[model samples]
Target: MDLASQIYERKSCRNYLDEEIDLDIIKDFISKCRPLNENINYYYEILTKDEVSVRTPWSAPYYLALYSEEKENYFENIGFVFQQVSLFLQSIGIGSCWVGMASPKKKKSNFVILIAFGKSEKMTRDRSSFKRKDLSKISDYEDERLVPAQLAPSAINSQPWFFKHSKDGFDVYQKKQNILKRQVFKNWNPIDMGIALAHLYVENEETFDFEIKNDFEELKGHTYTGSIKI
Candidate 1:
């Protein structure tokens, strides 16, 4: 199975087994992950159970800790880049989860987020099982191209993304949050938007073009993230 195909079947795995994967092979795959923004410098560290604390339904054998240089859209850059790792894991019969409620025991200035992954029993699911917003809810109009983003996972199921059609393509935005929701998701929201974009790129690897837009029309309740053509 390919990463693009796994998008429909992939879920936040909560049934990890006590097993180890070949670290060498995993490192190689991570080295080749598509970078939505290559200009942002980033690296990964494989940590064991001893290195971090996780509050989740399942425990993982290893956590892939992402560290990136801070810059505009860096959070989204990490989200866009590492999501491919999650999808790739599922394609190879491993399971993974994005653990926002996790922290490293020895936190560094650049540490961004954790991707908890490990061995699991291979599972199968279909589109009917997806819990997501309707196509119309995510965009001004229904678009088949936006299906991948519709099903993309966000922290606590926030699904904080919106799309607007453009003359050439479309623009992406992070949906604005209220005061209460903002407090809970201020940091995670940009990262979540990146994950949504990753789905579009993974499915359309050949022609995924992402660029910052300065002259974009302002959305009433959303922050412009980027422009996309795919």
Candidate 2:
């Protein structure tokens, strides 16, 4: 299937079979996976259940642990890189889910996120099965280009991104976190923005120049994250 098809068909799988993935295939995927930013230092390890601590009830036989040297846009970098891995796994029939609620008990580096992957009981989902905010709700301009971005996954399905048309392309922002939610999601929201960016990149191979402009006016409850020039 094509990349667009993979974006629409991929779904998070919570239940996984107790089977080991082929080491060769895993290595090949690692070699082929691309990161959004090449300048940052990031590391990943394929781990078994015994190597990590997960408080959630969902379980998978194999997990991919991601770590990065703390730097600017580190969380977003993690999301950008792993979302590629997630989409690739779905494209090849392996099941994967972003395990943000879980963490490694032993810290070798700055653990950013974990992905659980293995044989899943159910492999794919129809495009209509996606539970996402409508395009009208997510974007200021009426363009199909933003549809894939609307479907980008987030922690607690927050769907925290907003977009407005600009002369060159678009300006991206994150919804202002209310007091009740800020304490829990301050870090995860930027990661969600990165996931949306990955979807946008897959939809259109355009260059994006990220910047923070506090003076840029935004929707009533949103804050500026960055911009993309088409």
Candidate 3:
């Protein structure tokens, strides 16, 4: 499958087989990742399991450690950038899972998140396996384009993304979570938004353009993330 098809087929894989992967293909793909928020400074390193320390019980042979300067939308930028890499990994039949509870053993102040990747039998999911909200639940109205975004994986499935459509494009937001959810996934929400947007980008590669705009109408109880024309 091509990159766009990977969006639909990709699964957040946890269970894996004892298999090997070619790192050179991953290295080349990482070099070419197109950042959704290009203004933010970010970097990543693919490290072995020995280099990472995890709070989760599951493990992988390799982990992709993402780091970025703590600036506006840094986490979001990291998500948008590396999620593309995740899709690329999927295209190559490698499996990966976003490891929010993990970090490098020698963690830097700039460290953001880890994506644990290895060869797995469960690389793709049937559409029935995808437990996602309908388009009406995520957007203000019907839009088939939002289907891929609907399928995006989020931390604990707290799919906190909202879109308000307009004639020009659509404005995206991070839906506000209550105190209970916020305590657990406050940082993950923005990254989730970026991951959702990454799916839209993969689907509409030629026309995806994102920018922060001040003029869009306010979305009640939601924080403005960005606007996109695609």
Candidate 4:
């Protein structure tokens, strides 16, 4: 299926069978995802553990962790890189979830994205049941479609973003309400925001060009979050 359809059909998979992904499969997956930045790519590595202990929102059999050593914006790179892996897994009939908080005992891995494999399970409504605000409510478009921005994943699916539009383009900003801190991985709000921006850009590649706004204030507070034009 196409990327747009994959985005729509992709749901967080939290169940896995008693199976192991071959080392070759993992390598092949990475081969497909040539990193955009060489430096950031060098700082990240994918690790897997069979005996992983996880708590809330996850019941998958096995877990995968992407390890990063960068001090700043490393976790964000984790989100950005793993999103690609998760989408690739989905394309190959696998399921995944952003399990950053699920694995509490992980080392050198602050962010954990869960993937559920094997047979497909029953589809259920998302726990949030919160209605997706229409494009009219969150965007400035006359033709209403679920703007891919709404589909961007958050730290815990909190979806912490607000919208502002102008003659040039629209802006996405992060809200600092009820923010949660990561134990091992620091600096994720902006990183996740960047991941969300990547999704929005991939989904709307032809529509606009993404530009990183130099807002010193938003960048100052670690809790503050949001996106700018693209």
Candidate 5:
């Protein structure tokens, strides 16, 4: 399936069949995987159920742990890379979910995120089934390009992103976090931006150009993440 199709069809799968994915297939997928930022150093480790510690009561037969060296845009890079993997899993009939609350028992590196994946009956969902903000609510102007972004997933479904479009491209920003939610989402929100960018790429890969702009003035209540020039 195409990325756009995967974007519309994919759903978070928490329950899995009692089966283990073939290591060769996982390795093959990893070999083809490319991080959005190639300068960042990262690695992936496949952990069995016994090796993971989940804060909640969810269970999965396998967990994919992403570890990266601390650097600029590390979490965002992980989100971009893993989002691609998530879509790929959906295309290949595997079920996956971004498990932010789960962690490895032993810290090998800076653990960014965990993805739970395996064979599951609950895999895909119709496009109408996705509960997301409308394009107008997420972007400053109406542009069909932002549809996939509006559907991008985030921590607790916070959807902490906003976009302003211009002739040059779109300027991306993170919504201001209130005092109560700041502590929990400060680090996670950037990753959410990366996820949104991944969706944008899936929707417009041929023309999208992602650029980080430090000189752009921050909006009154939002934090600027980057810009996408098409």
Candidate 6:
């Protein structure tokens, strides 16, 4: 399936079937793509058998452990890259959840994120409501069209970010906040924005026949600064 369909078809699958995924499945997926940034790597690493822990029953047999040494941008990258992985898994009929609320098994890195993978337990439509915003609500008509940017995922579903149109393409930005991060919450907003860019560009290309050109630029009232053009 295309990335945009994958993005829209993807949902947070908290309830998974009691199924285990082959290690090779995840390994092959990660091995194929290199992350855009070097300070961090984006792929699922097999933790020790003990690395899998949870209060509730986990659906997918495998859980991916996200790790990074970058103090300010690790989680951002996790959010960014994992979103892509999440959608990819969905494309293949695998269920996943961005398991930030669960207790992580490893503690060696400055930041960490996790996603539970498995076959999903079927649910009614009412139980699967992931109400996303429309194109008009996220940006103004003159505002470089940020409709696709709203598809991004954030901490506890708190998509704390913003977007602005630039002379070049579109500038994806974040909102600065004094909110506290647990020792585990090493800031990952920039990387998340990068993943967000992936979704925006992918969806735009498939649906609108547009492509994004990345050009770094600075803007006010936004967190990290990046751009992609059509």
Q: Estimate each model's TM-score.
A: 0.96, 0.89, 0.97, 0.68, 0.94, 0.73
TM-score of model 2 vs. true structure: 0.89
Ranking by lDDT: 1, 3, 5, 2, 6, 4
Best by lDDT: 1
Better of 1 and 4 by TM-score: 1
Model 4 per-residue lDDT tens digits across residues 87-128:
666666666676655442455543434433432353234535
Once fitted onto the true fold, the runs of candidate 1 whose alpha carbons sit more than 4 angstroms away are none
In candidate 4, what residue range of length 10 has the lowest lDDT sum?
216-225
Global CA lDDT of candidate 2, please? 0.80
Residue-wise C-alpha lDDT for candidate 5, range 149-187, written one tens digit per residue: 888889889998899985698988889899989998877
Candidate 6 C-alpha lDDT tens digits along 49-84: 356666666434667777666644455555655666
lDDT of 2 by residue, 1-230 (tens): 35657788788899899987786776676676556567779888988888889988978888899888887677877887778777778877789988877877678758788888998979788888888888888888567878878888898999999899877778888898899899878888988888888777766654645554555765688877777754
Q: Each prediction's Cα lDDT score? A: 0.89, 0.80, 0.87, 0.52, 0.83, 0.57
Q: For each of the candidates, give the backbone clash count.
A: 0, 0, 0, 7, 0, 8
- Tens-place lDDT digits, model 1, residues 1-230: 47899889887877778876888878888898878888889998999978998886567888999999999899999999889888888888888888888878897889889998888775457889989999999999999999999989898999999999998888998899999999989989999999999999999999899999879999999999999999
Candidate 1 colliding pairs, count: 0
| lDDT tens per residue, model 3, 95-212 | 9999999999986878888999999988997888888888898999979988889989999998999889977789998999988988888889888988998889888889999988
